[model samples]
Target: MFMNWRRIRKWHFLRLISMCCVVSLLMVCWEHVDHHVVSHMKSYSYRYMINSFSFVNKSLSVSQEEAARFNSFPYLLNQNNVCKDKDVLLLLFVKSSPENFERRQAIRSTWGNESYVSHELGVILKVVFVMGVHTDVTNSFLLQDLHEEHKNYGDLVQQEFLDTFHNLTIKLLLQFRWMHENCAHARFMMSADDDVFVHMPNLVRYLQDLRRRNVRDHWVGHVHRGAPPIRSKNSKYFMPFDMYQWNSYPDYTAGAGYVISGDVAAKIYQATLSLNASMYIDDVFMGICAIAAGVSPQEHVYFSGEGRTPYHPCIYEKMITSHGHENDIRYLWKAATAPEVQGISSGLVGKLYCTAVKMMLLCKPYFSNTYSCMAAFT
Candidate 1:
């Protein structure tokens, strides 16, 4: 019995040693692959990562050398051939889908084809909407609420959706350089989704007001306080259930709508070169870059999301552009703009909005140049 017990103990000990050796080997191999290989996916130097699932379909990752191209990013920023023209150029990037034709039509209807509406405040600027397309039709992980029949023919949305969007984002810069010079926009570049309903006239007026004041940090949009990018499957930009043992989104960009000043755009484009990177929720990625580039994320009075959250009628009067959630729109339009439901835009409400602005500012200084994120910009 004693001899048998000794032999069994020896066997178990040997098995444990073998397991440790295997684990150590895996760790080394993984480190080697990550360090030697994963850094080269971007044609420009910033590290760009799409989901690993893309590995099975096509080996899509940027090489380190390609990422190195951005060392002179801002310095090499392609200025417009006609850079001297002082005009406003509106850059709108739309996430295109076939099902969104009506929404697209609504946007076109809202703005009309001319792209710019010149008003006394300023040239409403030549608008260039670079639709960020996600339409290939072979996606396996894409999700859309079949809630609307209109959004039926959606884009091929998989991990590839992220990859394609990022690539297009980079390529669009080329288009921006060409257009920026010809049109001569002085104030801003607004990047956003197709679903966003920008109160264009209102935005232009606000920007004009800012320009007269010489406020340079213009990456302005609705700010989600303490909002972080989510990493669970519940999130649109989720990782695999077992892949990462972490939760929460890094401080990131909201996908709805954001406007960055042309100077800041040039800075962000440059800062992309020096940073260690983050994953592909473009908003968050942009936010990360902004933080690195001495840019501050400003929360405006009007942006919002997640249909559950809506702006009360009292809330909308002073707001610049509300995110048009259907429940809110379907009813509010009825109350204010539509025929019957009266009393939407109330009078004493203006008083409440002005009061709130002051109160909110007193508590937390308004996000003006006087109050910047420079101390904690990164």
Candidate 2:
């Protein structure tokens, strides 16, 4: 009787262990299923939001005549006369005002200096300043100056649209048109503002890596996802309900600097033909068109959107672009591309040092907006 009782106890123990193992497996499977379900739901939500705002199909209420004019707009300034001989790898289109001559000159001397980039990096880079006509027609001197500048540099691409804050979309459209017509064969293209500072060495290296990997449909920069449109009338970014009813704009890279593959650029140009170009905000409008073209914008944590990134060696090591550098671009460029930074080893120890430096500098809350602060850390 004692032996039988002991055997029964052992059998019960074995059953219990089997049940526990089964439960553990079930829990793991459940967690995976839940994660997949959540991912699918998020994707569906984004698609539904985009479709909700797609009210018109291939019809633009905003000046059909102006839309038609995009294809045939004569270039008041052009780069075809100069860049015809070079097999360009990256074509940078900088959005500049007609009067920002000093800022343009600063850019030309620093990060936007194509000759320096090509000679140093051995990568063919072309820089073009995109502009529109001056709003005040009486400012003939500015126009004459622009003409002279273009004649000397052949780096300006200007259209007839009035250059104003509200007419930024026109400027962007002009860039797409010019890219399509002239530099479509380039491997990649970037749209940047005149005041922004680009780290040419880092950016060129990143693009070269992408090319080596044979990456396509690539659009990357500081991505803003689920960004709400400003509703306040007094806001500079005010969007009335009639203009955009959606609660969030499609994911878009910041206009301060964003890069797209040549194919993606062509696709965005085609998207412009079908979508209305009425949105005044160029970056957000680019997002809309990109979504329509089925191109997704990817986030690069190093790309500073509209805000200036805090200067640090760790930050500059991986930085791509920073905004609000109108006066300090040359200095910033010098610091970023210094020999010390270029020679930093990529070994584990060097990486650990940079990581520690970043933790010390970026772990704190900096920006007033909580999201912005978190993004800085990221």
Candidate 3:
């Protein structure tokens, strides 16, 4: 009886060890699955959360004194020679922070290289960085560095307002104000983020084509239609009923990079003064002003929105603007402007190659529902 009891006890101990091993293996598998799931969830939730925060912060009211200061403050730092040349074909305004010197420099060296565009393409492209004062009081040294950098570069347009995400609309207004006063004579104007990569050759070619076709009242980019404002309190683009009563926003181009005719730029500027500028979203506000001014946003597949375009020679040959290209701008510019690509004129074979590549790379099953190549220019 004692032997039998001992044997039973041993059997129970073995069973307990087996159970622990099973649990350990399950936990390992679960951890692997959870890592991927968590990563995807974070990426998916990041934009919504950021937009919600921006909306919530902007919803807060400023004091009477702060409002007065905001209204009365000037919106120019060094205007420089932005519009000195009346023969400027395209005026490129890049919205940058005061301390993003590396990004500005990268731009100047790559697609934003005005000298190269003028000398090589014979299209006068004036590039400037539009910015505002740094928000952090402790970052006084950074502000001073910005001042000196502006003095050396002579391409910064700064305002007196605090440079915060909630104040992006103010930045846009300042840009429009500058365009109205300083660079209105430019034939075409492009507003882009500092991180975007603008293919000057393609953009100039497109603009020149537009001029030949006499496409006036044009505001073209990646157009978002029938987009509703976020109602979630946790989203970065959340809009309260008190802030905006409209259920849907008017058709608007993505602010990442967009081009407008000089006339449209002036009209948008005028609309800003009359329309309510309480909304802090720069692109949405631009759309609102455009709607008020009777301008419609046009869709261009080459102009990317918040997302980056897939890189390929075929894609680059047609791409005008691609967002989120900080460190990769130089490489992309090189690839896009390669001699082989430049040599490929819009002929039958070239067109066929581009079409095939576009289908394979951009219109893949994975990219079908998302933003991808839609219509070829040719």
Measured by TM-score, the strongest candidate is 2
Better of 1 and 3 by lDDT: 3
Worst ten-residue run, lDDT, model 1? 369-378
What does the lDDT read for residue 270 in candidate 1? 56
Q: Compose the digit string of candidate 1's lDDT tens values, residues 72-108.
A: 1232111233225445445444444434546555555
TM-score of candidate 2 relative to the true fold: 0.81
TM-score, per-candidate, Cα-based = 0.53, 0.81, 0.78
RMSD (Cα, Å) of candidate 2?
Answer: 10.5
Ranked by lDDT, the better of candidates 2 and 3 is: 2
Worst 10 residues of 3 by lDDT: 49-58
Candidate 2, residues 148-218, lDDT tens digits: the string is: 99888878888777888888888888888888878888899999999998999999999999998989999
Highest lDDT against the true fold, candidate: 2
Query: Against the unseen true structure, what C-alpha lDDT does each candidate score?
Result: 0.45, 0.79, 0.77
Q: What is the Cα-based TM-score of model 3?
A: 0.78
On TM-score, the stronger of 1 and 3 is 3
